[model samples]
Target: MKWLWMTGLVCALFASVQAQPQPLPAEVQKRIDAIFDGVVDRWIVQMDRWWHDGQHEHLINMTYFAIMLDPHNISLYENAGWLLWSSDRDDEAVALYQRGLRNNPDVYDMYYELGQYYYIRKRDYAKAREYLEQAIKFPCEWFVWNTLGHVYARLGEREKAVETWQELLRRFPMMPVDQMEAVRKNIRDTMTRDTTPTAGENTQQ
Candidate 1:
């Protein structure tokens, strides 16, 4: 069944490539896109089944195929890398992330994922900080800021960590009250532990 599906995908992709020299009619293009989307959706379903059944190798193969079909799908890269990491294919996961960064140079999430891999898996604080810092240069999620702060703290840069958390609060003012308070508590705790500088003290200088 898997071989049949892969054969169909290969044939479809080959046909599409052969037809690429000529401009496809709008209606024909729409139908082609619909068919392609259907194939991808079915593949996703199969991948999910494989994942649940502990068929890690099969899932990883399908993930690689999915990336080949749609390299721009950021979620695919993230999920595939995570799967590899969880399966103890750590080198493959890092390589997959590097490939993702190559395909998506400007995406913040790729950097964030790499940062997380370094921080959590390798305990490489400097590398984590490097990637997390790059992640913040673009529009990113709240956790990026939070994790970067943690990285700074691990690196013994308590002041920078507090500032990072403070900046997170400033940027996401409408966040949930509990989350907001948690961040404030982190700031307070860090301040109490280290009296070197306040959150914005160094920035003022």
Candidate 2:
């Protein structure tokens, strides 16, 4: 993911260079250098530092400033929202992801990440299912389906969970056999657990 940010910076550098006039005005060049050095590089460093030290506040602020500098770079929005999430500012994180989606509706990762917050932390299975459904409509990884199945299970929708994992196998035929085996085991376990009588029912019988 950091590589995505680096690639964005490289593209920006190239675009700035190519857009320069033949004369390459001194002020324009200086501004470009300043943007790369002060904003882009600094943001990259802040993100790396956050990963190393768990410094979410500084990372979130720096990522926000980076977004201001390059609103078109979708990765900046993702990183900023993720920073807020890592800080446990979940509502703010969701809002930031929603804002990014408003600007770039095609970025499906926004939905996936937002859904992850609800599913993993808040236990808001409805919201998780909502956003994960949106995410699967577009191009995303297999894990989205896996998580959606978990959300379904959490809501006691075991049938839906089994179907969802089957769908994952259908959608990604090349997925590793071990992962598929895990899903199959999960489905079997859920079904068996459901059919098993409770201790109270056993006593009554």
Candidate 3:
């Protein structure tokens, strides 16, 4: 009876301690929580500071907080990755997108951004194609097909571009009207720009 009573007391104490709000560390957690407190209101202030002082690390920390505060908000992850990418942190941006996907696999748009990041920023076209393919697996995302078409066009895969456009048309007969002319414009632009210039023009004589 005595041993059982002691075990119960210990379990209750452990539960109480676990229930208490933790004193978040100063390194990133404290700062992030502070951002949660008023970070959105002063978001512009923090951004301006990043621009003026070139303190991207701080900005990254704040973004971490924003994401933590609204765990369900996929846009927070998008904004964090976008800012990091714009600031020339391609590796960090990639990691952020990967982490975001782990948390919110339903956020299809991150795949699009990750694809663009791979193609444009990292110059890893193969990885870009992989991500864009994943993005297209999601629903009602004709825009994703448009992006894939551009990627294939840039890669000089004419067959892929044609197939992409065909898929877009098949999905949306009024595709141009439905997607604000983006898919139609890509189809037209890729088909138009695909001309094999004269051999003389191809090689600067």
Q: Work out the TM-score per prediction.
A: 0.84, 0.69, 0.61
* Candidate 3 lDDT, 1-205, residue by residue in tens: 6533533554454455446687545675555545445634455466557747877666666666555445555666676687788888878888988888787677577788788788667766678889899888887466677767766766777678868877987886765574646566656655777463222331100
The TM-score, computed over Cα atoms with residue i paired to residue i, of candidate 2 is: 0.69
Per-residue lDDT for 75-184 in model 1, tens only?
77888899899879999999999999998989798999999999888878899999999999999878789888877877779999999999999999987788788788
Tally clashing residue pairs in candidate 3.
0
lDDT of each: 0.81, 0.73, 0.66
Point out where model 3 deviates above 4 Å.
Answer: 1-59, 173-182, 185-205
The whole-model C-alpha lDDT of candidate 3 against the native structure comes to 0.66
lDDT of 1: 0.81
Q: Taking the tens digit of each residue's C-alpha lDDT, what string does model 2 give over 1-205?
A: 7745765775677576877668577998787767666656666776777868977676676665566556556777777776777778878888888877776677578788778878766777799899998988998888888888877777778888889888988999888788878877777766777553232321100
Query: Tell me, what's the RMSD of every candidate?
Result: 5.6, 8.6, 12.0
Query: At residue 133, what lDDT does model 2 achieve?
Result: 89
TM-score of 3: 0.61
